[model samples]
Target: PAPTAAPPEFLLNAPGTWNLPMRTALASLPRSVWLLGLVSFFNDTAGELIYPILPLYLASVLMAGPRVLGLIEGIAEATGSLLKLASGIGADRMRRSKPWIVAGYAVAGLSRPLLALAASWPVVLVLRFADRIGKGLRSAPRDALLGASVPAHQRGLAYGLHRACDNAGSVVGPLLAAALLARQTPLDQIFWWASVGSVLAVLLTLLIKEEPAPPRPSAPRPDWRPGALPPAFRRYLVVLGVFTLGNASNMFLLLKAKDAGMADYQIPLLWAVVSLVAAVFAAPLSALSDRVGRRRLISLGWAVYALFYLLLGLAGEGWMMWALFGFYGLFMAATEGAEKALVADLLPREQLGTGFGWFHLVSGLSLLPASLLFGSLWEAWSPLAAFGSSAALALLALVLLRRWVGLPAQDGR
Candidate 1:
């Protein structure tokens, strides 16, 4: 059965029920939504623990520089983007999301243990590639499942809560890494621990009761055709591609933290702070999107990103970096879940996996050039040049979004 939409519970005259809307909304969510968030929480806890410190490991331990770091991240993201396109279509055609979801988690889980043995940057790059391939495999189907698990009004709530849960892991993961580093624990030990978290995510994934996929028409050729999707979705992808051209990996932001005179030991702690702030705000911002409108929220989030990028370039002190990073967290809260909800909003129920695949694909592919450009600019001129360029591109994307995304002045959602 389809998930039931919540009935309006607005009652201005009712005593002591000011929170009725929220309570009703919570009551309407499927159990799978919350369970899925927990699964992601564990999986991301594993991933973010490794994310915060990997750049430093590559630079400090493997004797690499900004260019190589950029190269590795760019390639890894590009590889995953390609696979997401394939996996999204596969989930739709196969009509079962759990097997692919399970396989993806298992692959990602087993790959992390190998990172403990990576003495060279090339080895690290390969492992990252493999790990992202696993991410690529699971992302679209997972999103489709989440959308299916809730009603339209509740999508932002579900996705937001999921982001909150996922970022909560990010918060803990970095702090965990910080604690381990402070104890003079070996890097290999941290990687091993990350594997433990990944395994937990896999186990939790097995507990999920996946909703069967809606059927699709048979086509001899692949279902990867972008033109065949909704016109609105296609247009949204266009603006998204332009915006993502400037949105590089958060590893650069971690690198920015280091450049702002944060101690090496403090980097993960700083990351923890960012994740903590994002976790706190993700649900509220996404819920606000449900009340107001997704397009407005998304545009605001992009503007926040632009402002943060510009501020990051100008930051000179540790305190300045701290403030800018907080804004970065706010941007993630405002956009991440809401963006996915907006995509699902724009497309039909049956087209969600494909739409989300295209969505992730455009965003993921843009990271390659974004990181490479930022890294080269850092190597050539200064951090100011790299970040200033990112700000400029982001502003342009914002203008395009405001002017051309074609959202109505008053949307019902």
Candidate 2:
């Protein structure tokens, strides 16, 4: 027998809900949404434990410089971006996602231990590559799983909750790192603890159950035909790619804080502040997108990001750094989940993994050039010049997108 109609509670419409359309949308969210959120919470907490402090560790502990930082980040991100496409294809071909998901997480988890053993900058590079390879393999499949699990109406909320939990981990991980640093814990020890956290994330993945893959069409579809994507999706991707080109790695931001004369101990606190703010706003802004439409929120996010980069470049003091970082967190809250939700809206159910893979590939690939350009500009001119160039690019992208693509309709499915 067909599954029974969802209970009234699950029907999305309920009395006194503030936004009836959004409420109806929320009602359709799947249990997998929250479960995946938990998985991200743990995984990102582990990832964040090392992420915020990585550049600092390279410079202070390993005695590397900006050029090396650029190379390492550029290579890692570029590799991961290519892998996103490969993994997506693999998932589609295998007709299985969970196994790849599990393998990816396991590889990432294992890579953390190697970080604990790194003896030189080159060793750190290898470990970072390994970790990112795991990220590259898993991100598309995991996102596809989330997209598959949720109803069309609630994609934003589902993606938002996932970002919230991921950002919440960002909050906790930095705090934990700060505490560990304060205790004079060795950097290797911190990596070891992060490895343990990754293990927990892998364990949680066991609990997640994906929906069966959709059956393929019997007739062969034409390859690369015109109107391949719904007009809305293609427009959205173009806009998103433009926005990402200017959104370089957070390492630059951290390095900026350090350049402002903030002590080593203070860096993690600043990151914690950013992550905390992101955690608070991610869900609400995502929920808001369910009402106001994701395009508007995304445009707003790009505008905010542009402003923050400009401020970071100009700000000369610690307090200004703190303020900018907080606002930066808000920018992340506005964009990350909304971006994922937009991708879900654009693609068909059967092609979710491929769509997400392509999405990750586009965004992730940009990081290489973004990071290299930022670093080279810093080395050649000044940090201000580097940041100013990125901000200008972002503004231009935002303008072009607004003029050309415009916003998608928000009918809540």
CA lDDT of each prediction against the hidden true structure: 0.81, 0.77
Please give, for residues 276-337, the per-residue lDDT of candidate 1 as tens digits.
87788787677777767898888899999999998888888887777778778988998998
User: What TM-score fits each model?
Assistant: 0.93, 0.90
Question: In candidate 1, which residue pairs get closer than 3 Å at backbone N, Cα or C atoms, i.e. clash?
Answer: none
Worst 10 residues of 2 by lDDT: 7-16
Give lDDT tens digits, candidate 2, residues 211-303: 777567684442222155567666656666676677777888898999899988789889988888888777667766666676778779889
> How many angstroms is residue 79 displaced in model 2 relative to the true structure, after the best TM-score fit?
0.6
lDDT of 1 at 362: 91
Candidate 1 lDDT trough over 10 residues, lowest sum: 9-18
Candidate 2, residue 34: lDDT: 76
Give the total clashing residue pairs for model 2: 1
- Which parts of model 1 have CA positions greater than 4 angstroms off? 1-20, 214-222, 408-413
